[model samples]
Target: MQDKPENLSREYILPDGRSVTVGDQLFRAPEALFAPREVEAQGPGVVGMVLRSLARCSSRIQLDILRNVVLSGGSTLFQGFKERLLKDLQAAIPSIAPVKIFSPENRILTAFRNMWITREDYYEVGEHKVKDI
Candidate 1:
C-alpha cells in the first residue's frame, strides 16, 4: 500500500477562534468500515457482509459475482478504499474466485443517476429489498 502524505497531522482554527489539531484519526476513523469492533459496533464489517451475502447465493454464480463487484456512494470515495477492499477480498476468498472492484471516478453521481431510491421507497421496502437492487 502506498503511504499517504495527507495523513499528517494539521491544525485548524474554528470560526470561534479555537484551534484544533487533527491527526491519524482521519485514517483510523475509516478503519471501522473494515473492522466494526474497533468502534464497539456489533456484526461483521463490510467485507464480511459481502461474504455473507455471497454465501446466500447459489455456488454457480459466486464467481460471476466476485468478478463484477461495483462500489458506490460517498463513503467509498475515501482514498485507497477500493484497493484495500480488493486486497482484503482477495485474501479472504478462494484464489480462483478473482475478485474485482469497479469504482467509477464519479461514483456518487453515478449512483444517483442509476440507483437513486426515494426515502419513502427505502422505508417501505426495507434494507433486504434494497440490497437486491
Candidate 2:
C-alpha cells in the first residue's frame, strides 16, 4: 500500500464501521507548540518559553545552559522536534551563543531519574523555595 500524502485528508473506518476524516489537524496540533498564537493562545510558544527562561538565568551561565539543553517527555518524542528547536533558538539567540538540544532515546525515563524534588524537602522549604531546585 502507498502512503498517503500528509497534506491530503484521509478517512479511517472505525471498528464499528463508521468513517471519520482526518485532515490538517494532525499537522497543526503539533505545530501549536511552536506557534501558540496560531491556535489563539495568548502567550509565547515552546521556543519563546525556553528563551524567556534562559533570559531569567544569569548571563554567565546562559552559554552553559544552551550547551546542555535536554528535551524529554512525550512532546519531545515528536519527529524533528530537537532540530526545529535548535534551529529556532539559533535564529533567535546571538551568533556567539551556541545551541545544542539533546533528545535521549529513553528521554522520559532519563528526565525522571535526573530531576526530582523530595516531598520532605518540599515541605521543609515550601513551594516557592522548592521551585528553584
Candidate 3:
C-alpha cells in the first residue's frame, strides 16, 4: 500500500489555493474513499463482507453482475487479499455475471486523474501541469 503513489497524479487546485500534484497527493488518501459513512458495511468486519459477497456467486454460470470495482488505499495490502477477495466474491455473486477489480496499482488516483481532466475540459477551471501545480 505504501509503495503505491499517494496521488500518482497531481494538478488539482485545492481549496487552499495551491496545486496538488499526482506524486505528492498520491498517498494523501481521504476517508471518504474507503467507504461511505452513511452505509454500514462492517459485516463480520471487512473479511465477512468479502465472504458474503463471494457466497452469492457460483461456478455454473461464471456471471459478472458486479463490475468496475477499484480497490486502493492502505486496506488493499492485507495478507491473502487478492485471492481471498476473488474466492469470496466468486462465492457471493456467483450468478451476477462478470465481477472484476480493475487495478493492481493506484486505481483510485487514476479515477481522480480522469475527474481532474473532465473538470478542465468541461468547466475550464481544472487545467494543471503537474510541475506548475
**TM-score, predicted candidate 3 vs. hidden true structure:** 0.34
Query: What's the C-alpha lDDT at position 26 in model 3?
Result: 38
* TM-score top scorer: 1
Q: Tell me, by lDDT, which candidate is best.
A: 1
**CA lDDT for candidate 2:** 0.84
Displacement of residue 107 (Cα, Å) in model 1 is 1.3
Over 1-133, each residue of candidate 1 has an lDDT whose tens digit, in order, gives 8668575887999999999998887777778899989989898998999999999999999999999999988889888899989999999998978998999888878656846678898899889667877
TM-score of each: 0.70, 0.68, 0.34
Clashing pairs in 2: none
Comparing 1 and 2 by TM-score, which wins?
Answer: 1
Tens-digit per-residue lDDT, 12-114, candidate 3: 8999899865563333333222333424433354435544565677844323334545566556654345555656565655464556765567644553553
Lowest summed lDDT across 10 adjacent residues in model 3 is found at: 27-36
RMSD of each: 7.5, 7.1, 12.1
Model 1 misplacement above 4 A: 1-7, 10-21, 114-133
1 against 2, candidate with superior lDDT: 1
- Model 2 misplacement above 4 A: 1-21, 110-133
